[model samples]
Target: MPSVRVVSLVPSLTEAVAVTAPGTLVGATDWCTHPADLDAVRVGGTKNPDVPAIVALAPDLVIANEEENRAPDIAALRAAGVDVLVTEVRGLDQAFRELERVLDACGAERRPGWLVAAEAAWRNLGAPSAGATRHAGRLRAAVPIWRRPWMVLGRDTFAGDLLARLGVDNAYAGHAERYPRVPVEELRAAGLDLVVLPDEPYRFTRDDGPEAFPETLPAALVSGRHLTWYGPSLAEAPEVLGAALRAVYR
Candidate 1:
């Protein structure tokens, strides 16, 4: 019983809805590029969505996220009589709850199998030990999404939380800002044991980002979607991220 027509302003949510209930998505942002075979109309991007075009779709509902979509756009859509459900996902558990809520809103009664599988995968990781990262296997990590201004994961971020669950301590975990901007030289001198780079938000690659770090310091270049995306990708994220990190996080 999915909505007759729906639009997704966020890429992650787009993948979630598109996969969970395929034909419901009538329009999506240009950045929604998952499911390789998604057949939704393109309606601009996450930051600057085409409100008029979205309204033209006459969607019964529009899905969005607090951090990814602008407030003004949501308000405009609401004013136009479109039902917009905005999500706030700050952690792994929260992500699950939010995804379920979005699906329920879309008239989905049963949670998708992937959601259950993803939860089971992470739950199997168990709890972090009292002194898990004390010895040689201890890892002090810096995750940079964008390098132009040198922004690194800080404070209570989903990526940082996942890294911590994987036994990798975020170097800026105690920083006041969630995403702190630090100079490259400072990052290099921050005594980091490893730098976990993702191929998104800036697409850091082996040749492009690894060279920025010292030869002695190891860097794990992993998939940004797997590391940051919280959707159907979650089912494989634990294994995928673990394998990627293990490959280079030594």
Candidate 2:
């Protein structure tokens, strides 16, 4: 069978398809940075893609995520008669299922080793040992994705689910919106044991993010790729994220 030529609008999906079936991708958004030597045509950013450029690629399939992409873009692709596979990944399980579906649509012969390894890694993740931490209890944390206006991970977020699995509970996990713009003052006063910061959507570095929180609160400055992107990074997410979380306590 001729390989399916793919265009990936989502960064995570782009990495997934590219890593699992190299050369299968003909176009990817500018944000698809994984596999750093990716040779696909740059279609533009996730929020504002060059629709005409993507359509012109004539990919056999185009994969996108509901959160990272806009509806009008997906609709425009569909209107142009391009076969678009849209995925919604709210949690770890959904991410795995969506990865498998996206790969199958891309005509991958089987599940990639990375995908299998990612699943196994999460399954075998042991509970967080509080004994090693200065704070000896379950960690109630607030995950801030962006600043300026200060947006946070709220209910039904993929990152929150991963944190939950690692025993770090998101303080805003019960909030109404998946990503909510809460006041910075409120976040600081949210009675959090830790402040989880990732380096994307907004780059939260040691100097940048930690200063905002009270000196009493621990900060876990982590890789946003591992925390947010649901691709091969998932395989190392547990270890990378767990270590970051643990470091704040140690």
Candidate 3:
């Protein structure tokens, strides 16, 4: 087997790959914290990598995600003759496929027992019945990701897919971008059942002043990655999100 040193440029894959193949990781971005030991590397943001620093690392492979990483930087890395594996996962199936690809690239084959276990767990944890029943009465949710311009999760996004899976309809499904900015008044008119403040992308907290919302509306701060990105993390989300939704109903 070829000994390959990998520099991870995307945060999610940085975390995922580190878990799948810790020994192969030579360098990683600041946000890759799952494995803990790789935190010693010089910090690099997900969108912008430290090119010279990466070159200095002289990795055999560079891992990145198509959506999270900028194309020009990937192009630059390729121009420097660095082998790059770019993953684009829009859904659960795509996510599993990308994981498989990463494992294969790192010379790690699938552990059939683990796959079977994960599959069994996923199958056993069915969708929330309460959420489905409450769907009709469910408030169209405005998942504000950013504040200044009021960006939200739009239709055709991973978050939107999760919303659908959770039995709640995304109010911004008609919008264009995956995350778009909308006026506060527009949100009020949309008649939302809940205003979900995610813990990331904007880091909305309970003490962060819910006075911005009308007194009649209910709001809850939720785990952004759990509601949005579905990967290995998703194995934990069905239970977590179901509990959250059940709480909202109760």
Give me the candidate number with maximum lDDT.
Answer: 2
TM-score of each: 0.93, 0.97, 0.87
* lDDT values, one for every candidate: 0.86, 0.89, 0.70
In model 1, how large is the Cα lDDT of residue 237?
86
lDDT of 3 by residue, 87-188 (tens): 887665566677778767876554433344444555675553435646645456788888777888886766666656666667888777778888887877
Q: Where in model 2 is the C-alpha error above 4 Å?
A: 130-132
lDDT tens digits, residue span 11-49, model 1 = 888898888887988999999999889999999999999
Off by over 4 Å in 1: 126-137
Best by TM-score: 2
lDDT by residue (tens digit), candidate 2, 1-250: 3479899999988888888888999999988898899999999999999999999989889898888999999999999999989999999999999998998999884578998899999999876653237545678889999899899999999999998898888999899999999998998888988899999979988899899989988888999999999999999999998888877766
* Evaluation by lDDT, superior candidate among 1 and 2: 2
Full-model lDDT, candidate 1: 0.86
Pairs of residues at least 3 apart in sequence or in different chains that clash in candidate 3: 139-193
Clashing pairs in 1: none
